[model samples]
Target: MIDDRILVKNVLAGDMQAFRLLIRQHEKLVAHMIGRLVKKDEEREELCQDVFLRVHEKLGEFSFQSKLSTWIATIAYRYAINHLRKQKIRFADLPDEESFTKHFIEETDPESIVEEGDTDAFVLKLVDELPPQYKTVLTLYHVEGMTYPEICEVTQMPEGTVKNYLFRARNLLKEKVKKYLGKEELL
Candidate 1:
Protein backbone atom coordinates (compact mmCIF):
# COMPACT_ATOMS: atom_id res chain seq x y z
CA MET A 1 0.00 0.00 0.00
CA ILE A 2 1.27 3.46 -0.85
CA ASP A 3 1.89 5.85 1.99
CA ASP A 4 -0.69 8.64 2.11
CA ARG A 5 1.88 11.43 2.07
CA ILE A 6 3.63 10.04 -0.96
CA LEU A 7 0.31 9.43 -2.74
CA VAL A 8 -0.88 12.94 -1.99
CA LYS A 9 2.40 14.38 -3.16
CA ASN A 10 2.22 12.39 -6.37
CA VAL A 11 -1.29 13.53 -7.06
CA LEU A 12 -0.37 17.11 -6.41
CA ALA A 13 2.51 16.83 -8.86
CA GLY A 14 0.01 16.31 -11.70
CA ASP A 15 0.00 12.54 -11.81
CA MET A 16 -3.39 11.47 -13.13
CA GLN A 17 -2.69 7.89 -12.09
CA ALA A 18 -2.02 8.97 -8.55
CA PHE A 19 -5.24 10.97 -8.53
CA ARG A 20 -7.11 7.88 -9.62
CA LEU A 21 -5.28 5.91 -6.97
CA LEU A 22 -6.37 8.43 -4.39
CA ILE A 23 -9.98 7.98 -5.45
CA ARG A 24 -9.62 4.22 -5.44
CA GLN A 25 -8.26 4.32 -1.92
CA HIS A 26 -10.89 6.60 -0.48
CA GLU A 27 -13.99 6.02 -2.61
CA LYS A 28 -15.43 3.42 -0.27
CA LEU A 29 -14.99 5.73 2.69
CA VAL A 30 -16.82 8.48 0.85
CA ALA A 31 -19.49 6.10 -0.36
CA HIS A 32 -20.07 4.60 3.07
CA MET A 33 -20.37 8.02 4.69
CA ILE A 34 -22.66 9.39 1.99
CA GLY A 35 -24.65 6.19 1.65
CA ARG A 36 -25.66 6.17 5.31
CA LEU A 37 -26.71 9.81 5.26
CA VAL A 38 -28.34 10.17 1.83
CA LYS A 39 -31.41 8.02 1.16
CA LYS A 40 -32.38 9.03 -2.35
CA ASP A 41 -31.10 6.48 -4.87
CA GLU A 42 -30.85 8.93 -7.76
CA GLU A 43 -28.82 11.44 -5.78
CA ARG A 44 -26.23 9.03 -4.38
CA GLU A 45 -24.00 8.63 -7.40
CA GLU A 46 -24.09 12.32 -8.25
CA LEU A 47 -23.34 13.20 -4.63
CA CYS A 48 -20.34 10.89 -4.65
CA GLN A 49 -18.98 12.51 -7.78
CA ASP A 50 -19.44 15.93 -6.22
CA VAL A 51 -17.49 14.78 -3.15
CA PHE A 52 -14.51 13.72 -5.25
CA LEU A 53 -14.69 16.95 -7.14
CA ARG A 54 -14.41 18.86 -3.89
CA VAL A 55 -11.55 16.64 -2.81
CA HIS A 56 -9.71 17.33 -6.00
CA GLU A 57 -10.26 21.04 -5.67
CA LYS A 58 -9.08 21.11 -2.08
CA LEU A 59 -6.21 18.64 -2.29
CA GLY A 60 -3.60 21.33 -1.93
CA GLU A 61 -5.05 22.62 1.31
CA PHE A 62 -4.85 19.36 3.22
CA SER A 63 -2.21 19.72 5.91
CA PHE A 64 -2.13 16.01 6.71
CA GLN A 65 -3.22 16.57 10.31
CA SER A 66 -5.60 13.61 9.94
CA LYS A 67 -5.66 10.55 7.79
CA LEU A 68 -6.66 11.23 4.20
CA SER A 69 -9.59 8.90 4.52
CA THR A 70 -10.82 10.73 7.61
CA TRP A 71 -10.52 14.08 5.84
CA ILE A 72 -12.38 12.68 2.86
CA ALA A 73 -15.05 11.32 5.17
CA THR A 74 -15.46 14.77 6.65
CA ILE A 75 -16.01 16.19 3.19
CA ALA A 76 -18.50 13.49 2.25
CA TYR A 77 -20.39 14.09 5.50
CA ARG A 78 -20.60 17.84 4.93
CA TYR A 79 -21.81 17.36 1.38
CA ALA A 80 -24.46 14.88 2.44
CA ILE A 81 -25.66 17.16 5.19
CA ASN A 82 -25.83 20.07 2.75
CA HIS A 83 -27.71 17.92 0.26
CA LEU A 84 -30.14 16.93 3.00
CA ARG A 85 -30.66 20.55 3.88
CA LYS A 86 -31.21 21.44 0.23
CA GLN A 87 -33.94 18.80 0.13
CA LYS A 88 -35.29 20.07 3.47
CA ILE A 89 -34.81 16.69 5.13
CA ARG A 90 -35.12 16.75 8.87
CA PHE A 91 -32.25 15.36 10.87
CA ALA A 92 -34.16 13.29 13.36
CA ASP A 93 -32.81 12.64 16.78
CA LEU A 94 -32.91 9.11 18.11
CA PRO A 95 -36.13 8.58 20.03
CA ASP A 96 -36.06 7.38 23.60
CA GLU A 97 -34.53 3.91 23.66
CA GLU A 98 -37.42 2.11 25.28
CA SER A 99 -40.01 3.65 23.00
CA PHE A 100 -37.88 3.13 19.90
CA THR A 101 -37.27 -0.51 20.73
CA LYS A 102 -40.94 -1.13 21.35
CA HIS A 103 -42.01 0.62 18.18
CA PHE A 104 -39.39 -1.05 16.00
CA ILE A 105 -40.27 -4.55 17.05
CA GLU A 106 -43.99 -3.96 16.89
CA GLU A 107 -43.87 -2.35 13.48
CA THR A 108 -42.41 -5.36 11.74
CA ASP A 109 -44.67 -8.08 10.36
CA PRO A 110 -43.59 -11.71 10.42
CA GLU A 111 -43.91 -11.91 6.68
CA SER A 112 -41.67 -8.90 6.20
CA ILE A 113 -39.20 -10.35 8.65
CA VAL A 114 -39.12 -13.71 6.91
CA GLU A 115 -38.87 -12.15 3.50
CA GLU A 116 -35.78 -10.16 4.54
CA GLY A 117 -34.49 -12.88 6.80
CA ASP A 118 -30.76 -12.41 6.64
CA THR A 119 -29.72 -11.34 10.11
CA ASP A 120 -27.00 -8.94 9.01
CA ALA A 121 -29.17 -7.21 6.47
CA PHE A 122 -31.98 -7.04 8.97
CA VAL A 123 -29.63 -5.38 11.43
CA LEU A 124 -28.49 -2.95 8.74
CA LYS A 125 -32.10 -2.06 7.95
CA LEU A 126 -32.57 -1.23 11.61
CA VAL A 127 -29.41 0.82 11.57
CA ASP A 128 -30.71 2.70 8.57
CA GLU A 129 -33.73 3.82 10.55
CA LEU A 130 -31.53 5.48 13.16
CA PRO A 131 -30.94 9.21 13.14
CA PRO A 132 -28.27 10.48 10.76
CA GLN A 133 -25.85 11.17 13.59
CA TYR A 134 -26.16 7.65 14.98
CA LYS A 135 -25.89 6.09 11.56
CA THR A 136 -22.78 8.16 10.68
CA VAL A 137 -21.01 7.32 13.94
CA LEU A 138 -21.96 3.66 13.68
CA THR A 139 -20.82 3.34 10.09
CA LEU A 140 -17.53 5.21 10.65
CA TYR A 141 -16.58 3.33 13.80
CA HIS A 142 -17.99 -0.14 13.18
CA VAL A 143 -18.23 -0.46 9.43
CA GLU A 144 -15.19 1.60 8.43
CA GLY A 145 -13.16 0.43 11.43
CA MET A 146 -12.17 3.96 12.42
CA THR A 147 -11.03 4.79 15.92
CA TYR A 148 -13.08 7.08 18.13
CA PRO A 149 -10.74 10.00 17.51
CA GLU A 150 -10.95 9.46 13.78
CA ILE A 151 -14.74 9.40 13.99
CA CYS A 152 -14.66 12.56 16.08
CA GLU A 153 -12.63 14.28 13.41
CA VAL A 154 -14.87 13.09 10.62
CA THR A 155 -18.16 14.08 12.29
CA GLN A 156 -16.68 17.14 14.07
CA MET A 157 -18.21 15.81 17.27
CA PRO A 158 -16.40 15.91 20.59
CA GLU A 159 -14.88 12.69 21.89
CA GLY A 160 -17.53 12.46 24.59
CA THR A 161 -20.32 12.88 22.07
CA VAL A 162 -18.82 10.32 19.72
CA LYS A 163 -18.47 7.79 22.52
CA ASN A 164 -21.94 8.59 23.78
CA TYR A 165 -23.44 8.14 20.35
CA LEU A 166 -21.64 4.84 19.89
CA PHE A 167 -22.82 3.52 23.22
CA ARG A 168 -26.38 4.62 22.65
CA ALA A 169 -26.47 3.37 19.10
CA ARG A 170 -25.17 -0.05 20.09
CA ASN A 171 -27.57 -0.34 23.01
CA LEU A 172 -30.47 0.66 20.80
CA LEU A 173 -29.52 -1.94 18.21
CA LYS A 174 -29.06 -4.60 20.84
CA GLU A 175 -32.46 -3.99 22.31
CA LYS A 176 -34.11 -4.06 18.92
CA VAL A 177 -32.36 -7.29 17.96
CA LYS A 178 -33.22 -8.95 21.25
CA LYS A 179 -36.86 -8.07 20.87
CA TYR A 180 -36.77 -9.10 17.25
CA LEU A 181 -35.33 -12.49 18.12
CA GLY A 182 -37.83 -12.99 20.87
CA LYS A 183 -40.63 -12.30 18.43
CA GLU A 184 -39.00 -14.55 15.87
CA GLU A 185 -38.96 -17.38 18.38
CA LEU A 186 -42.66 -16.98 19.13
CA LEU A 187 -43.63 -17.18 15.49
Candidate 2:
Protein backbone atom coordinates (compact mmCIF):
# COMPACT_ATOMS: atom_id res chain seq x y z
CA MET A 1 0.00 0.00 0.00
CA ILE A 2 1.25 3.45 -0.81
CA ASP A 3 1.46 5.76 2.16
CA ASP A 4 -0.49 8.91 1.37
CA ARG A 5 1.82 11.30 3.16
CA ILE A 6 4.97 9.98 1.60
CA LEU A 7 3.45 9.58 -1.85
CA VAL A 8 2.05 13.07 -1.81
CA LYS A 9 5.29 14.52 -0.55
CA ASN A 10 7.40 12.73 -3.10
CA VAL A 11 5.00 13.54 -5.89
CA LEU A 12 5.16 17.19 -4.99
CA ALA A 13 8.91 17.01 -4.94
CA GLY A 14 8.93 15.99 -8.59
CA ASP A 15 9.77 12.33 -8.08
CA MET A 16 8.53 10.45 -11.12
CA GLN A 17 8.45 7.10 -9.31
CA ALA A 18 6.17 8.49 -6.64
CA PHE A 19 3.84 9.85 -9.28
CA ARG A 20 3.69 6.47 -10.99
CA LEU A 21 3.09 4.79 -7.62
CA LEU A 22 0.21 7.12 -6.89
CA ILE A 23 -1.38 6.22 -10.19
CA ARG A 24 -0.78 2.53 -9.63
CA GLN A 25 -2.39 2.65 -6.23
CA HIS A 26 -5.47 4.62 -7.22
CA GLU A 27 -5.98 3.88 -10.91
CA LYS A 28 -8.39 1.03 -10.23
CA LEU A 29 -10.58 3.26 -8.13
CA VAL A 30 -10.66 5.89 -10.89
CA ALA A 31 -11.29 3.24 -13.54
CA HIS A 32 -14.19 1.74 -11.63
CA MET A 33 -15.87 5.13 -11.22
CA ILE A 34 -15.14 6.14 -14.81
CA GLY A 35 -16.25 2.79 -16.22
CA ARG A 36 -19.51 2.99 -14.32
CA LEU A 37 -20.28 6.45 -15.74
CA VAL A 38 -18.65 6.56 -19.17
CA LYS A 39 -19.97 3.90 -21.60
CA LYS A 40 -17.65 4.26 -24.54
CA ASP A 41 -14.36 2.46 -24.01
CA GLU A 42 -12.28 4.91 -25.97
CA GLU A 43 -13.87 7.83 -24.19
CA ARG A 44 -13.54 6.09 -20.84
CA GLU A 45 -9.85 5.49 -21.41
CA GLU A 46 -9.34 9.11 -22.38
CA LEU A 47 -11.24 10.31 -19.34
CA CYS A 48 -9.14 8.07 -17.13
CA GLN A 49 -5.95 9.55 -18.48
CA ASP A 50 -7.38 12.99 -18.07
CA VAL A 51 -8.26 12.20 -14.47
CA PHE A 52 -4.64 11.32 -13.65
CA LEU A 53 -3.33 14.38 -15.41
CA ARG A 54 -5.63 16.55 -13.37
CA VAL A 55 -4.64 14.70 -10.24
CA HIS A 56 -1.01 15.40 -11.00
CA GLU A 57 -1.66 19.06 -11.55
CA LYS A 58 -3.72 19.40 -8.42
CA LEU A 59 -1.57 17.33 -6.09
CA GLY A 60 -0.29 20.51 -4.47
CA GLU A 61 -3.74 21.51 -3.28
CA PHE A 62 -4.61 18.21 -1.69
CA SER A 63 -5.50 18.90 1.89
CA PHE A 64 -5.19 15.91 4.18
CA GLN A 65 -8.93 16.17 4.83
CA SER A 66 -9.92 12.71 3.58
CA LYS A 67 -8.18 9.67 2.27
CA LEU A 68 -6.26 10.35 -0.94
CA SER A 69 -8.41 7.81 -2.71
CA THR A 70 -11.59 9.70 -1.87
CA TRP A 71 -10.18 12.95 -3.25
CA ILE A 72 -9.14 11.19 -6.44
CA ALA A 73 -12.54 9.55 -6.75
CA THR A 74 -14.27 12.91 -6.36
CA ILE A 75 -12.23 14.27 -9.23
CA ALA A 76 -13.15 11.21 -11.25
CA TYR A 77 -16.84 11.61 -10.49
CA ARG A 78 -16.90 15.26 -11.56
CA TYR A 79 -14.95 14.60 -14.75
CA ALA A 80 -17.13 11.69 -15.79
CA ILE A 81 -20.35 13.54 -15.07
CA ASN A 82 -19.02 16.52 -16.96
CA HIS A 83 -18.11 14.31 -19.87
CA LEU A 84 -21.58 12.74 -19.86
CA ARG A 85 -23.20 16.16 -19.95
CA LYS A 86 -20.88 17.48 -22.64
CA GLN A 87 -21.54 14.51 -24.87
CA LYS A 88 -25.29 14.79 -24.21
CA ILE A 89 -25.40 11.05 -23.70
CA ARG A 90 -28.88 9.63 -23.92
CA PHE A 91 -30.42 6.31 -23.07
CA ALA A 92 -33.62 4.99 -24.56
CA ASP A 93 -34.68 3.00 -21.52
CA LEU A 94 -32.94 4.18 -18.41
CA PRO A 95 -34.16 2.11 -15.47
CA ASP A 96 -35.85 3.99 -12.70
CA GLU A 97 -33.88 4.09 -9.47
CA GLU A 98 -37.17 4.12 -7.59
CA SER A 99 -38.43 1.11 -9.49
CA PHE A 100 -36.23 -1.47 -7.74
CA THR A 101 -38.35 -4.22 -6.18
CA LYS A 102 -38.00 -4.55 -2.43
CA HIS A 103 -38.55 -8.29 -2.67
CA PHE A 104 -35.07 -9.57 -3.38
CA ILE A 105 -34.48 -13.31 -3.64
CA GLU A 106 -32.92 -14.75 -0.51
CA GLU A 107 -31.48 -18.03 -1.66
CA THR A 108 -29.98 -19.79 -4.63
CA ASP A 109 -28.87 -23.37 -5.31
CA PRO A 110 -25.56 -24.10 -3.61
CA GLU A 111 -24.23 -25.12 -6.97
CA SER A 112 -25.16 -21.81 -8.49
CA ILE A 113 -22.32 -19.89 -6.93
CA VAL A 114 -20.07 -18.55 -9.62
CA GLU A 115 -16.81 -20.26 -10.37
CA GLU A 116 -14.16 -18.61 -8.21
CA GLY A 117 -12.41 -16.63 -10.92
CA ASP A 118 -15.45 -15.09 -12.54
CA THR A 119 -17.44 -14.07 -9.46
CA ASP A 120 -16.04 -10.54 -9.21
CA ALA A 121 -16.67 -9.87 -12.89
CA PHE A 122 -20.16 -11.29 -12.63
CA VAL A 123 -21.00 -9.13 -9.64
CA LEU A 124 -19.56 -6.07 -11.38
CA LYS A 125 -21.83 -6.67 -14.39
CA LEU A 126 -24.83 -6.75 -12.09
CA VAL A 127 -23.59 -3.61 -10.40
CA ASP A 128 -23.21 -1.98 -13.78
CA GLU A 129 -26.94 -2.32 -14.35
CA LEU A 130 -27.66 -0.08 -11.39
CA PRO A 131 -28.63 3.57 -11.82
CA PRO A 132 -25.66 5.93 -11.88
CA GLN A 133 -25.94 7.19 -8.31
CA TYR A 134 -26.53 3.76 -6.85
CA LYS A 135 -23.70 2.23 -8.83
CA THR A 136 -21.32 5.07 -7.96
CA VAL A 137 -22.24 4.75 -4.30
CA LEU A 138 -21.77 1.00 -4.38
CA THR A 139 -18.42 1.20 -6.13
CA LEU A 140 -17.09 3.93 -3.83
CA TYR A 141 -18.40 2.26 -0.71
CA HIS A 142 -17.88 -1.43 -1.30
CA VAL A 143 -15.35 -1.71 -4.08
CA GLU A 144 -13.17 1.14 -2.80
CA GLY A 145 -13.73 0.22 0.87
CA MET A 146 -14.60 3.79 1.75
CA THR A 147 -16.57 4.87 4.81
CA TYR A 148 -19.88 6.71 4.55
CA PRO A 149 -18.28 10.08 5.21
CA GLU A 150 -15.60 9.36 2.67
CA ILE A 151 -18.32 8.39 0.21
CA CYS A 152 -20.13 11.62 1.05
CA GLU A 153 -16.95 13.52 0.30
CA VAL A 154 -16.77 11.98 -3.13
CA THR A 155 -20.50 12.08 -3.94
CA GLN A 156 -21.68 15.21 -2.06
CA MET A 157 -24.63 13.20 -0.72
CA PRO A 158 -25.79 13.44 2.86
CA GLU A 159 -24.72 10.71 5.28
CA GLY A 160 -28.24 9.26 5.33
CA THR A 161 -28.43 9.34 1.56
CA VAL A 162 -25.12 7.50 1.34
CA LYS A 163 -26.40 4.78 3.62
CA ASN A 164 -29.68 4.57 1.73
CA TYR A 165 -27.99 4.33 -1.63
CA LEU A 166 -25.71 1.59 -0.39
CA PHE A 167 -28.61 -0.39 1.03
CA ARG A 168 -30.81 0.14 -2.00
CA ALA A 169 -28.03 -0.73 -4.44
CA ARG A 170 -27.30 -3.94 -2.59
CA ASN A 171 -30.95 -4.87 -2.51
CA LEU A 172 -31.32 -4.09 -6.20
CA LEU A 173 -28.26 -6.20 -6.98
CA LYS A 174 -29.51 -9.09 -4.88
CA GLU A 175 -32.78 -9.13 -6.74
CA LYS A 176 -31.08 -9.07 -10.10
CA VAL A 177 -28.46 -11.71 -9.23
CA LYS A 178 -31.00 -14.12 -7.86
CA LYS A 179 -33.13 -13.61 -10.92
CA TYR A 180 -30.12 -14.34 -13.10
CA LEU A 181 -29.49 -17.51 -11.14
CA GLY A 182 -32.98 -18.74 -11.91
CA LYS A 183 -34.16 -17.98 -8.40
CA GLU A 184 -36.68 -15.37 -9.43
CA GLU A 185 -39.57 -17.70 -8.69
CA LEU A 186 -38.45 -18.00 -5.08
CA LEU A 187 -38.58 -14.28 -4.35
Candidate 3:
Protein backbone atom coordinates (compact mmCIF):
# COMPACT_ATOMS: atom_id res chain seq x y z
CA MET A 1 0.00 0.00 0.00
CA ILE A 2 1.22 3.50 -0.79
CA ASP A 3 1.51 5.81 2.22
CA ASP A 4 -0.75 8.83 1.74
CA ARG A 5 1.78 11.02 3.53
CA ILE A 6 4.54 10.05 1.16
CA LEU A 7 2.20 10.13 -1.81
CA VAL A 8 1.06 13.64 -0.93
CA LYS A 9 4.67 14.74 -0.54
CA ASN A 10 5.60 13.26 -3.91
CA VAL A 11 2.49 14.72 -5.52
CA LEU A 12 3.36 18.13 -4.16
CA ALA A 13 6.82 17.70 -5.61
CA GLY A 14 5.29 17.40 -9.12
CA ASP A 15 5.14 13.63 -9.41
CA MET A 16 2.27 12.59 -11.67
CA GLN A 17 2.73 8.98 -10.64
CA ALA A 18 2.14 9.88 -6.99
CA PHE A 19 -1.05 11.72 -7.93
CA ARG A 20 -2.25 8.65 -9.77
CA LEU A 21 -1.16 6.50 -6.85
CA LEU A 22 -3.29 8.55 -4.49
CA ILE A 23 -6.30 8.20 -6.74
CA ARG A 24 -5.79 4.47 -7.15
CA GLN A 25 -5.51 4.03 -3.41
CA HIS A 26 -8.74 5.83 -2.68
CA GLU A 27 -10.77 4.94 -5.76
CA LYS A 28 -13.12 2.49 -4.06
CA LEU A 29 -13.92 5.00 -1.35
CA VAL A 30 -14.67 7.66 -3.94
CA ALA A 31 -16.83 5.28 -5.96
CA HIS A 32 -18.82 4.10 -2.94
CA MET A 33 -19.55 7.67 -1.85
CA ILE A 34 -20.54 8.86 -5.31
CA GLY A 35 -22.60 5.76 -6.00
CA ARG A 36 -24.81 6.34 -2.97
CA LEU A 37 -25.26 10.09 -3.36
CA VAL A 38 -25.51 10.66 -7.11
CA LYS A 39 -28.91 9.62 -8.48
CA LYS A 40 -28.07 9.17 -12.10
CA ASP A 41 -26.16 5.96 -12.90
CA GLU A 42 -24.60 7.14 -16.14
CA GLU A 43 -23.10 10.23 -14.53
CA ARG A 44 -21.46 8.43 -11.60
CA GLU A 45 -18.06 7.77 -13.17
CA GLU A 46 -17.79 11.26 -14.61
CA LEU A 47 -18.64 12.75 -11.21
CA CYS A 48 -16.06 10.51 -9.54
CA GLN A 49 -13.44 11.71 -12.01
CA ASP A 50 -14.43 15.26 -11.23
CA VAL A 51 -13.88 14.61 -7.52
CA PHE A 52 -10.35 13.34 -8.14
CA LEU A 53 -9.64 16.27 -10.45
CA ARG A 54 -10.69 18.68 -7.75
CA VAL A 55 -8.59 16.76 -5.25
CA HIS A 56 -5.59 17.20 -7.52
CA GLU A 57 -6.26 20.93 -7.83
CA LYS A 58 -6.66 21.36 -4.10
CA LEU A 59 -3.86 19.02 -3.10
CA GLY A 60 -1.68 21.90 -2.07
CA GLU A 61 -4.32 23.22 0.33
CA PHE A 62 -4.56 19.92 2.15
CA SER A 63 -3.36 20.72 5.64
CA PHE A 64 -2.80 17.10 6.61
CA GLN A 65 -5.07 18.03 9.50
CA SER A 66 -7.04 14.87 8.80
CA LYS A 67 -6.33 11.53 7.17
CA LEU A 68 -5.89 11.92 3.44
CA SER A 69 -8.73 9.43 2.76
CA THR A 70 -11.07 11.40 4.98
CA TRP A 71 -10.19 14.63 3.20
CA ILE A 72 -10.63 12.95 -0.19
CA ALA A 73 -13.95 11.54 0.99
CA THR A 74 -15.07 14.98 2.07
CA ILE A 75 -14.36 16.16 -1.43
CA ALA A 76 -16.23 13.20 -2.91
CA TYR A 77 -19.27 13.82 -0.73
CA ARG A 78 -19.42 17.52 -1.60
CA TYR A 79 -19.03 16.81 -5.29
CA ALA A 80 -21.77 14.19 -5.32
CA ILE A 81 -24.17 16.30 -3.30
CA ASN A 82 -23.51 19.20 -5.63
CA HIS A 83 -24.05 16.99 -8.65
CA LEU A 84 -27.36 15.83 -7.22
CA ARG A 85 -28.41 19.42 -6.77
CA LYS A 86 -27.40 20.31 -10.33
CA GLN A 87 -29.67 17.53 -11.62
CA LYS A 88 -32.72 19.36 -10.22
CA ILE A 89 -32.04 22.55 -12.16
CA ARG A 90 -31.80 23.82 -15.68
CA PHE A 91 -28.71 25.49 -17.18
CA ALA A 92 -30.25 28.89 -16.59
CA ASP A 93 -30.87 28.17 -12.94
CA LEU A 94 -28.22 27.78 -10.28
CA PRO A 95 -29.07 25.36 -7.48
CA ASP A 96 -29.55 26.30 -3.86
CA GLU A 97 -30.15 24.19 -0.77
CA GLU A 98 -33.81 25.17 -0.79
CA SER A 99 -34.20 23.87 -4.34
CA PHE A 100 -32.39 20.63 -3.65
CA THR A 101 -34.41 17.55 -2.79
CA LYS A 102 -33.71 13.84 -2.97
CA HIS A 103 -36.36 12.23 -5.12
CA PHE A 104 -34.79 9.07 -6.34
CA ILE A 105 -36.81 5.93 -5.50
CA GLU A 106 -34.24 3.44 -4.29
CA GLU A 107 -34.11 0.20 -6.19
CA THR A 108 -32.72 -3.15 -5.13
CA ASP A 109 -30.06 -4.49 -7.40
CA PRO A 110 -30.68 -8.03 -8.62
CA GLU A 111 -26.95 -8.29 -9.03
CA SER A 112 -26.57 -7.84 -5.28
CA ILE A 113 -28.16 -11.25 -4.83
CA VAL A 114 -25.82 -14.22 -4.78
CA GLU A 115 -26.13 -17.96 -5.40
CA GLU A 116 -24.66 -18.95 -2.05
CA GLY A 117 -27.16 -16.95 -0.02
CA ASP A 118 -28.94 -13.60 -0.04
CA THR A 119 -29.05 -12.36 3.53
CA ASP A 120 -26.18 -9.92 3.20
CA ALA A 121 -27.48 -8.76 -0.15
CA PHE A 122 -30.98 -8.34 1.20
CA VAL A 123 -29.62 -6.28 4.07
CA LEU A 124 -27.84 -4.00 1.62
CA LYS A 125 -31.02 -3.70 -0.45
CA LEU A 126 -32.84 -2.48 2.63
CA VAL A 127 -30.01 -0.08 3.39
CA ASP A 128 -30.61 1.45 -0.01
CA GLU A 129 -34.10 2.31 1.17
CA LEU A 130 -32.80 4.63 3.86
CA PRO A 131 -32.72 8.42 3.53
CA PRO A 132 -29.42 9.77 2.25
CA GLN A 133 -28.37 11.10 5.64
CA TYR A 134 -28.95 7.72 7.21
CA LYS A 135 -27.30 5.91 4.36
CA THR A 136 -24.33 8.25 4.33
CA VAL A 137 -23.63 7.86 8.02
CA LEU A 138 -24.13 4.12 7.85
CA THR A 139 -21.77 3.74 4.92
CA LEU A 140 -19.12 6.02 6.33
CA TYR A 141 -19.05 4.21 9.64
CA HIS A 142 -19.67 0.63 8.60
CA VAL A 143 -18.21 0.39 5.11
CA GLU A 144 -15.49 2.98 5.27
CA GLY A 145 -14.59 2.10 8.85
CA MET A 146 -14.60 5.74 9.81
CA THR A 147 -15.32 6.89 13.34
CA TYR A 148 -18.06 9.30 14.37
CA PRO A 149 -15.72 12.27 14.25
CA GLU A 150 -14.39 11.21 10.88
CA ILE A 151 -17.92 10.83 9.51
CA CYS A 152 -18.77 14.24 10.91
CA GLU A 153 -15.78 15.68 9.08
CA VAL A 154 -16.78 14.00 5.85
CA THR A 155 -20.51 14.84 5.89
CA GLN A 156 -20.54 18.01 8.00
CA MET A 157 -23.01 16.23 10.24
CA PRO A 158 -22.83 16.78 13.96
CA GLU A 159 -21.38 13.93 15.95
CA GLY A 160 -24.74 13.38 17.65
CA THR A 161 -26.49 13.28 14.29
CA VAL A 162 -23.96 10.78 13.03
CA LYS A 163 -24.58 8.48 15.99
CA ASN A 164 -28.33 8.91 15.63
CA TYR A 165 -28.29 8.05 11.96
CA LEU A 166 -26.05 5.07 12.53
CA PHE A 167 -28.25 3.77 15.30
CA ARG A 168 -31.42 4.40 13.33
CA ALA A 169 -30.02 2.85 10.18
CA ARG A 170 -29.05 -0.29 12.08
CA ASN A 171 -32.48 -0.58 13.66
CA LEU A 172 -34.03 -0.24 10.24
CA LEU A 173 -31.81 -2.97 8.88
CA LYS A 174 -32.67 -5.23 11.79
CA GLU A 175 -36.36 -4.66 11.23
CA LYS A 176 -35.94 -5.43 7.54
CA VAL A 177 -34.03 -8.55 8.38
CA LYS A 178 -36.87 -9.66 10.61
CA LYS A 179 -39.37 -9.07 7.87
CA TYR A 180 -37.25 -10.93 5.36
CA LEU A 181 -36.93 -13.85 7.73
CA GLY A 182 -40.70 -14.00 8.20
CA LYS A 183 -40.20 -13.19 11.86
CA GLU A 184 -42.58 -10.28 12.11
CA GLU A 185 -43.52 -11.45 15.60
CA LEU A 186 -39.96 -10.83 16.76
CA LEU A 187 -39.91 -7.32 15.40
Best by lDDT: 1
After TM-score superposition, the amount by which residue 92's alpha carbon in candidate 1 deviates from its true location, in angstroms, is: 5.2
What is the C-alpha lDDT profile of model 2 across 1-187, one tens digit per residue?
A: 7679999999999999999999999999999989988888999999999999999999999998888988999999989988977888642235454444532233322234365546667777667766788889898877789999898888888999899878988877766767666666544
Error of 1 at 36 (Å): 0.4
Pairs in steric clash, model 1: none
Candidates' TM-scores?
A: 0.88, 0.81, 0.81
Candidate 3: where are CA atoms >4 Å away?
89-116, 183-187
Q: Write the per-residue lDDT of candidate 3 for residues 78-168, one digit (tens) a residue.
A: 8877876677632224234222222122233333353347766756767776667777888888899998889999999889978987887
lDDT of the structure predicted as candidate 2: 0.81
Q: Which pairs, if any, clash in model 3? A: none
Q: Worst 10-residue stretch by lDDT in candidate 3?
A: 97-106
lDDT tens digits by residue: candidate 1, 1-187: 7999999899899999999999999889988889999987779899999999999899999999998998999999999988988888866545676787677666754346546667667778888877789899999998899999898888889999999988878876766666656553432
Instruction: List clashing residue pairs in candidate 2.
Output: none
Better of 1 and 2 by lDDT: 1
Candidate 3: residue 26 Cα off by (Å) = 0.3
* lDDT (Cα, 0-100) at 177 in candidate 2: 66
Order of the predicted models by lDDT, top scorer first? 1, 2, 3
